[model samples]
Target chain A: MQAPVLGVKALFFDVFGTLVDWRTSVARESEKILGALGFDLDWLAFADAWRGEYQPGMEEVRSGRLPFSKLDVLHRANLVRMAPRFGLENLSDEVLDDLTLVWHRLDAWTEVPGALTRLKTQFRIAPVSNGNISLMVDLARRNGLPWDAILGAEIAGDYKPKRQVYLAACAAFDLEPRQCMMVAAHSSDLAAAAACGLRTGHIARPNENGPGKGEASPSVPVDVAGSDLADLAGKLGV
Target chain B: MQAPVLGVKALFFDVFGTLVDWRTSVARESEKILGALGFDLDWLAFADAWRGEYQPGMEEVRSGRLPFSKLDVLHRANLVRMAPRFGLENLSDEVLDDLTLVWHRLDAWTEVPGALTRLKTQFRIAPVSNGNISLMVDLARRNGLPWDAILGAEIAGDYKPKRQVYLAACAAFDLEPRQCMMVAAHSSDLAAAAACGLRTGHIARPNENGPGKGEASPSVPVDVAGSDLADLAGKLGV
Candidate 1:
């Protein structure tokens, strides 16, 4: 383990691909909700399509082309748009709603729960994801992720990579940017957080998008980098 | 125990004097911080003086005479205002700041942690407090309060008793007002929440102001009422 940074009083995490394996988890959950409906297709591909719409949806709000909406609201709209291609358009709103909520039920990567529990002992931990407050709450409740508060896009009334999300999160905890650390698997998230004057910790999620398709290390400079959240916790001497 | 309210998916609690004994706890913490500095006076009276300024401070924000400020900021202002009356106006800013933060170190009532823990198993739990997110986070950390998210005045951009505060809390969770319950020891808080269409649960803190002073029963009609948080949890079958 490398030396830990001092003055880091809070740790803000990127939820989707950093703490949880959204691809596999969403794929499994979508299948459960859709398989019984006799609409079977490439479940992994389905999950990818669902996530693939995330950026564009957030861009609509980030760019001010559309008013800000909760991540689930956008997900529902995107689901309705993409369902026809997979022969799922005929489904009722009830089933489609169930499918949209899969984001709330994403399973944490194997070490996430234990790692977060340990990390929390030394610092205030929260998700600074693009996910909305309710979405974040559901994920924490379902996965045993102990967050000191729910804060992110919804609280900031904007999407991530935007400066408000990171800054608002730090201010919400009554800490200066230097006292908060952004922990994520993606180089992009760390870079944005660093731009806002926050320290950054990178957690390797090599299989986040499937084998060899995710970040094994941060592409940008960070205060700390490690193999996983548990490794990050160990590196910080948690 | 009375029958539990059906469809109550979330519980929003009023903090200070409700979940925790703010008066006594703040008095003790204030003495610990101030006594060593050679300031000897009536600590309980000191606590009352500090609390006495709270509503007036919040009124400044509620009336739009001042922009919304976190409870801590207003507390600091109130602290500085009251310092002269206590013959301690010469205190340094650092000392005054510490004095203002005693609100964060308050102790929970004896049955709060256990009851809250049990209720959490059946419903989503959070503090819809006038205290800002950081203040609530500090209190939760110092005590054993398990909150799913910190919500309330800060999130709503206004003080409680405002319609927006109650409505915004429900909207944040993607829940209808009817599906959420406002639990507090004050009838005024409950009445306001009920006016916003939320169910109400009352927890009696008969000694909140002082023994035999606080209402052992609510003055306004409530969906449910009990002796304390634990009894409310039991009434709800938690």
Candidate 2:
């Protein structure tokens, strides 16, 4: 293995696609809840539509059209907006709530648990995603991810790609941005993080969007790259 | 066990005196560092004097006299103020910085780890402390305190007994105040938490101060009380 990057004291992860397999998990959960209701829509497309609204939902807050709100609240609003299009317009609050909470029960990519446990020995590891604190906590509890702290949008009062979100996570550790590494599968997320002076690590998630969706890897160079979390751990010399 | 307080889902702890024996730990760290520098003074009294300034320091921000700042920054200021009185007028920047970080190395009370471990099995546990996130993370890592998240002054932008701190912690869990319990050794802290509609758990740290300092338990009634964390865990049926 190559020598680990020097002076990196913490690892901040991008959760939705980089760590948790939200696509499959959400699809499974939507199938269970919607199937029981006798709604036979394409669950994966429903999941994609729900997720596609994430950026625009955050953009409302980011653009100051709406005040800062938790991701869960934004997600619920988006879910409500999409329900009618998906033919589940009359779903009860109970079903809607369960479908929304599927984000909390997301399955971590196969190597997440052990890789994080290994990396944690050498560095403080935390999520720096757009997920709100409660959602992050529930996801951590459900997936057994060992996080040193739950930090993200709710903690920053803003979503990622916002300079404050990245800087605030670094400040939370009392460390300089260069002393931490932002790990994500998306080039755009890493580029935003790198612009804020954080070191970058990339985990290639070629199947993050499901079999044919092909979510692309970083176009920009990263300090480290791995096929999976275990590969990242190995390369980090953890 | 009496049903674990019905619907209590999270336990928020007071860190300084309740979970950690800060007086002892701070005194020891001070003695070790200062003694090596050829200084001799009332170390325990120094610890108390340093800690006694906590609430007043926070009041500056809570009252809006100053903008929000991390506890570490406030702690350094307090250390600077108290330095000359102990004949440490010429302390170097590095030494002062190290001394300020002693709060990060406090030892947990003997029963804390096992008790928290047990309680974590049944409910979320976190520190609702005045210490900044970095300090809390350091203390957790040093002492094996299993926190679901670090929530406190940093997140709330205000110090405790302020409704914002308690409310923010509850909000982080997406919980009502009544569904969360404030666990502390100080009645005043618990009382403030109760005023915000949270349940309260009392842990008796009769020796939190120096041997004869005689720190007292809660003067008001608490929902649960125990001689130590183990006793508290047993009482909570964890």
Question: What TM-score against the true fold does each predicted structure earn?
Answer: 0.98, 0.97
Per-residue CA lDDT of candidate 2, range A1-238, in tens?
A: 3444688999999999999999888988989888887888888888899998989999999888999999988989999998888877888888778888889889998899989989988999999999989888888888888889988888898888999999999999999999989999898999999999999999988888887454455689788988888988888888
Classified by CAPRI criteria, candidate 1 counts as high
What lDDT is reached at residue A59 by model 1?
Answer: 93
Clashing pairs in 1: none
Regions more than 4 Å wrong, model 2: A1-4, B1-4, B212-216
lDDT for predicted candidate 1 compared with the true structure: 0.91
Error of 1 at B232 (Å): 0.6
Tell me the tens digit of each residue's lDDT in model 2 across B1-238: 5754789999999999899989978999998888998888888899998988888888899899999999999999989987788788899999999999999999998889888989988999889999999999999889888788999999999888899999999999999999999999999999999999999999888777776453456788789888888998888887
Predicted model with the maximum DockQ: 1
Interface RMSD of each: 0.6, 0.7
CA-lDDT, candidates in order:
0.91, 0.89
Sliding window of 10 residues with minimal summed lDDT for model 2 chain A = A209-218
Worst 10 residues of 1 chain B by lDDT: B1-10
Runs in model 1 lying further than 4 Å from the true structure: A1-4, B1-4
